[model samples]
Target: MTRRPTQLLLATLVLTVTVGGCSNQNHTEAPPPSGSPPAPPTTQGQFTLPPVSPITPTSANAAPTGIPPAVAPPQVDAAPFNDPLRVTTAWMRQFCQTDFMEPINENLSRAATYATPAATAADITRGDTTQSYQQMQQQKLATRCDQVEASINPEAPATPSMVYVQVSAARTQLADGRPFQRLPLASTRRVVRGGDGRWLVDSAVDAG
Candidate 1:
C-alpha cells in the first residue's frame, strides 16, 4: 500500500541518523609507488586483485572465521541550543488577555516566528479576515463578561481573573454571523535575548 506524505514527513522529522561505516568489501590494494611503473597485467589483460581468505566451515554450518565487525568512529559531544532570550507561551497569553483592540491589531509583536518573511507578512495581512463576525460576537461576549465580572468582584485578590478571546479561521464572517468551521490555523513562538539582557519574543508563526 502507498503511504501518505505526512507520514513520511513525520518519520523524517523523528529519525536521528549517524554516518557510519558500510558492510561492503573493498580491497585496498596499495597502488605502485608514486611515479613508479604500472602494475603488470595478468592472463587475458585482466589485472587481478589479491584474493580474500575463505572462511573455514564449522560444525553448526557457520563460518569459523566470523565477518569483520563494522567499526564506529569516536563519538563527539554535540553542541546545545543555548539561547537565553527565548519566548515563552506565558508571554503570549499575558499579551492576549491584557491588550484590547476593537477592529484588529495587525502590528502586534506575534508575527516573527515564521521560517520565512512572507509567512510573517501573511500573518499580519490576514489579521482582519474575521473582524466583522468578531464584532457581533464581541457584543454577546461583552454582555457575558459584564455579568460574570459583576458576580465576581475584581478587587478581591483571591478572585481569579478570566479573559475571553475568540480565535477564528482564514475566511471572513459577517458581523452578525458564524465563522467557518474547518479553517486551518497554527502558531509557533520563540523568544531570544534582548540587548538589555532580557528575554524577548523574537518570532511567531500562524501557520507551519
Candidate 2:
C-alpha cells in the first residue's frame, strides 16, 4: 500500500519527536505517565516520501547543521535575492527549537507570531496537516532534541509577498517513545513577507 505523508504519520505514529517538529496543539495537561508510550496512537512504516537534497549550512539555503547561525548574513549583494534564503533558514531554526512546554496558550501564541496575517490560527493548531506539534503539548511530552536543517525550494512559486522552502530533520532520540526507529522527515513551508519586509511562516505542507 502507498504510504501516508510524514506529517500525518509522524503525528500518529508516535514519538516525543522534537516538540516543535510537527503541527497541531491543545491546552496544557499534566505530563502523561512516564513511559506511557510516546504517542497516544501509533502505526509505523506506513508513511513515506522521496528524499530531498540535504542542507549545507555554511552557504545559502542551508539549514543550521544543528544550532542555526547566530544571525543572517549582515549584507547581501541584493536584498531581493538574499532575503528568501537567509530568512527562511533563520526561521527554521526558531521553528525547530521551541521548548514544547506550557503556558500552553502562550506557546501556541508565540509559535503563531511567526505566522503571516493571512495564516489561520485554527490550521496552525489542529488543521488536517502533518503537524501534530501543537497537540503534542497537550500531552506534555518532554524532549532533548534541538536544531534543524532546511533548503530553498527553488521551484516553489513566489510572488512579491510569498515564498516556500522545504525542510528536513531526523529524530535521533526516543526519550518519549515512538512506534518506529528514528528517521528523517520533511515539510514544505509557505512563507510571506510582511509590511515591515520581514519574512514569516505563512503555513506548510508536510510530506503528507
Candidate number with greatest lDDT: 2
Question: What TM-score quantifies how close candidate 1 is to the native fold?
Answer: 0.25
lDDT of 2 by residue, 21-134 (tens): 553465466898887867645423342322335544443334323322222222332343336555545444333333334344333344454555455474445532324555
For residue 85, give model 2's deviation from the true position in Å.
3.3
State each candidate's clash count: 10, 10
lDDT score at residue 104, model 1, on the 0-100 scale:
47
Error of 1 at 188 (Å): 2.1
**Which candidate tops TM-score?**
2
lDDT of 1 at 55: 36
Candidate 1 local lDDT, 1-208, one digit each (tens): 9889999887766563311122224436677789998766663223222233443544322322221221222123121112211122222222232112333442233323311254345445654446643543343211000000001113422211121112222211111121111112223443343344443333442342
TM-score of 2: 0.43
* Least accurate 10 contiguous residues by lDDT in model 2: 172-181
Clashing pairs in 1: 85-191, 85-192, 85-193, 86-191, 87-191, 112-203, 112-204, 113-203, 113-204, 132-175
Candidate 2 stretches greater than 4 Å from native: 1-82, 97-101, 105-107, 117-123, 127-140, 144-147, 172-181
